[model samples]
Target: MTIEITGSAQWEAWQAKVLPPVERVADGLWSIPVPIPDNPLRYVLVYALECREGLVLVDAGWDDDVSWQALTDGIRTIGAHITDVRAVLVTHHHPDHLGLAGRVREASGAWVALHTLDAAVARPGLSPEERSEDIRSHLELHGIPGDEARRTVDLLDVGRALQSPAPDVLLEDGEEIRLPGLELKTIWTPGHSPGHSCFYQPDRRLLFSGDHVLPRITPQIAVYSQTAGDPLADFLRSLERLETFEVDEVLPAHEYRFGRLDRRLADMTRHHIERLAELRAAARETPGRTAWELSARLAWSRPWESFDATSRRFAMAETIAHLVLLENRGELRRGADRPVRWYPAATI
Candidate 1:
């Protein structure tokens, strides 16, 4: 069953499909709804934790003026200015999560902290050519034609990394946040991103599930230039780690706050199992077909042709992630060729 906090303004706003009002979740803790431009998720909930020195934020929203305004204005609700923010603990390197950390640092001299692995590639790389090559290579792996892939790469929004600057501090798993009046521990959950983390406040019994877990929509786990091997396996193992946590409520990066994380984790796992089964069937029916070809046979929220280049890129990456997982499980064999194809391991 989905867990909902009793009479939460966030829940009401979620139902209304609008931005939730700023709420003081617990003593010395506040949740701010900062807008994300043109995203269906609407807003990212930036949590401000009070300390003797000043306020420390869990995540910052997008770098747009509107998002910055919402973040600053939300901070004002708790009688603090943007300048009062002393530190920012980033959840991951996503534009929606770590975008404004630089601006926040400029305004408040706040130190930004990100996981070591994510910090390595979170900053904008030096060469666009390298990025284009990476995109071409990625597309080729999924059987996208060279000319078509080039055109698609030209249109894809690959500049997202520009908003995420490097962090001031590199975080490690199980490390305690030493800010006054709080006890937040970093839980390294590498799946959604190589260095995604969830903050656990043991004293308050709250878990800040940054994109690692959400109330509704499943977090996208896809293969990309920054992604390492078998992200699906990493994601499932991370879920198991989180299942051991004892918490009263889960404060996700997006969506409203909820409880019963165990159920959510189980449901996400089941969703992946069903998805993998569908992909397995598709592979069996069209053995030796490329991942790109098999992707059309799988289920998606919308029709395949309706997806634009960026959306299709995400879909293809997600499909590759699943295919790679199946291969790792010894259920499928990947062809050793450019524009790689998949075949059933049992038949091979």
Candidate 2:
């Protein structure tokens, strides 16, 4: 798909790295562009669904004064106020998606919902020490060096900024969102996060793919302490499952909307396949290299040297995911060292 099918005057605005105007997506649906400060993803499209009681929001924007104002004002453009919101359906536990949920609930008295798995992580259940330890363990496991590892752990709190509020409602996979006059079904698509979800409307034939599928960017499929094991495998399986849906149009969280779900799914799968092949080849050539070393060698949107502390941690996480997937596939084997290195499975 191209920008020609973006379906709104959002192409130039997107390229210029500016917020696009809120637009009515359909007769009963409205898309509100709420700004996400300092992020490459300039904004998140919070979809408003008209219902008998009031309005149901697909996702809340980031939790900040600017983001809140943009969200509230965007709702106003749709002839409603934040207080008119009946519920907020969050796609995942990431701060950008789940950040404003609590505030929205407080303002509108709306019930906020998330996948049960994500809700567990996003909830105020984990102590600060516990979270910090998790980050430390994740970095250490991925072979981040002493000083750099500490710096990255410190940055995870301040730089990445994880402040997901507890959700009111917890949903399971394949569960239907019980909103009046809305037939949205929650499709659990993990990998980006342990419990990322996409909402689908059978009648409307529209998929609200929240980071599960994007027009241009592939969502970061990283593995951290919370997301241990083979995340790449989970990501691929989820992509295959989504191809079963008969989607006419797709409304993504970031970027603009588009169609051709099958094509997008195929392209994303192929992209990951290519990355796996590259990693396997690298393992064969180099023999045993730590995840961090292998990660810096992998292709990224930007140069590895240009990556900041938080970006390196995320890059390592994704690299570990691919490495773990390769190990599971018997293409690579992990060497039991302090920081763990990978080798070609056949050679091992």
Which candidate gets the maximum lDDT versus the true structure?
1
- lDDT by candidate, in order shown: 0.88, 0.85
Clashes of each: 0, 0
Angstrom error at residue 346, model 1: 3.0
Highest TM-score scorer: 1
lDDT of 2 by residue, 1-348 (tens): 332255556656787777888999898899898898888898998999999889999999888999999999999998999999999999988888988988999999999999988877675456677778777876887689878888887765533344577778888899987667777899999888878999999998999999989888789997777775677888899999998899999999988888888888888998999998888888888988899999888888889999998889888888888888988888889887777888988876
Q: Kindly provide the TM-score of model 1 when superposed on the true structure, using C-alpha atoms.
A: 0.96
For candidate 2, give the lDDT of residue 31.
89
Residue 201 displacement (Å), model 2: 1.0
The list of candidate 1 runs beyond 4 A from truth reads 5-7
